[model samples]
Target: MKKVLIVFVFSIFMILIFTVDFPIKGDSLYGKYVNTNYQNTICCVEAPHEPDTLILFNDGKFESKFYGKGWFEIYNGISPRIQLHYTSFGKAALFNTYFSNKFFEKTKIILNADMNHTYTKID
Candidate 1:
C-alpha cells in the first residue's frame, strides 16, 4: 500500500511538471520564431498592425499567423508547402506555395492583400 501511494504521488508530480506552461518570452513575433527552433530564416515583410502568433510542435511543425489574419503552416513534406489567404478591398486570394521549409526562410506579404487569417493544427 505504501509503495502504491508513493508511485501515485510521483506520477502526479511528473504530470504537473511536464504539463506546465513553459512560455519563452521575447518580442512576441521575433521571439516566437526563435523559440520554435526555426533558426534565423524566418522573416516578415510589411509588418502587420497587430502581433503575430505562433503554434509550435516538437515534431518540427509550426503554424504562424499575423493578428490582421495573414497566416502560414509548415508540414513535413518532401517540399515545403504553404497556403496563404489574405483579403484586400473586400477581395481575397488563397495563394499556395510549393516550397519546402528547409529551403524557404521568410514569410512574405504583398501590399493591397486581404489580412484576416486563421490556422488550425492537426496531429
Candidate 2:
C-alpha cells in the first residue's frame, strides 16, 4: 500500500512539472546562435510582418520563414523544431518583407536586442 501511494505522488509531480509554463527569454537572442551556441551579433528583426520572411542568423545558417497562421515558424534545424504556434502573445517589432503561408499561428519571441542588421548562423 505504501509503495502504491508513493508511485501515485511521483506521477502527480511529474505531470505538474510538464504542465508548468516555460517562457523563452527575449534577452537570450541578443547574441548569435551558431548551430546551437549563442554568439554576439548585431542583427535582429521584429514582427507584424507576414510569417515568410527568411531570418539569417549571425552564425551562417538560415531560418526559413515561419508558416502556419499566427504561428512563428522558427526553423533552427534542430529538435522541438516542428512548427510552434504562439500559445501566448507579446510585443515584438516587425521588419523586412513578408511572405504568405497558410499555417499561421500566434507566437512570441523575446529579443535580446533590436533588429537592425542581417546576421548569419553557421553550423
Candidate 3:
C-alpha cells in the first residue's frame, strides 16, 4: 500500500511539473520589438506620428518610443497573452493592452493591440 501511494504521488507531481502550462521566462522575451507599419491614426485619442517600437527587459520592465515605460506580464495557456501596462506621455495613453501572442516562434512574434502587427525580435 505504501509503495503504491508513493508511486501515485510521484506520478501526480511529475504530471503537474511537466504538463502544466508554465509561462516563458522574461529572458526569452527580452529584446526590442519593432512595428514598422503601426498606425494609431484611427484611434480616438491622438498618438505619435512615428512608428512604435517596444523594448522588453529581463526584469519585466518595458519601454517604447511612444508608449513610455511600464511593467509587462505574460500568461501562458492555449492562447498565450502578453499584457503591456504602459503610460504614454502624449494623448495616446493606454493603461494596459492584452497583446495576443499570435505567432511566437523564436525571433518573430505577432501582436495585436487593435489590429494585427507583426513584430520581429531584435537584440
Clashes of 2: 33
Could you tell me every candidate's TM-score relative to the true structure?
0.27, 0.26, 0.53
Cα lDDT tens digits for candidate 1, 1-123? 999999999999887655432322222212133112222333443333334454444443444554224544443244334445555457774555432111122322221223312221121
lDDT of 3 by residue, 22-104 (tens): 44454666789776445644443423346777798878888887668888777656545666776555443434333333223
Q: Which portions of model 3 show Cα errors greater than 4 Å?
A: 1-26, 39-49, 88-115
For model 3, what is the alpha-carbon lDDT of residue 46? Answer: 29
Q: Which pairs of residues clash in candidate 1, taking residues 3 or more apart in a chain or in different chains?
A: 69-116, 69-117, 80-99, 80-100, 86-114, 87-114, 88-114
After superposition, the stretches of candidate 1 with alpha carbons farther than 4 Å from their true spots are 1-67, 70-75, 98-123
Top-lDDT candidate index: 3
Error of 1 at 84 (Å): 0.9
lDDT of 2 by residue, 13-119 (tens): 88765543333234332232222112335243233233233343334333443421232333332111213233224544232232111122112232232442222
How badly does each model clash, as a count of residue pairs?
7, 33, 0
Q: Which runs of model 2 end up more than 4 angstroms from their true locations? A: 23-49, 52-123
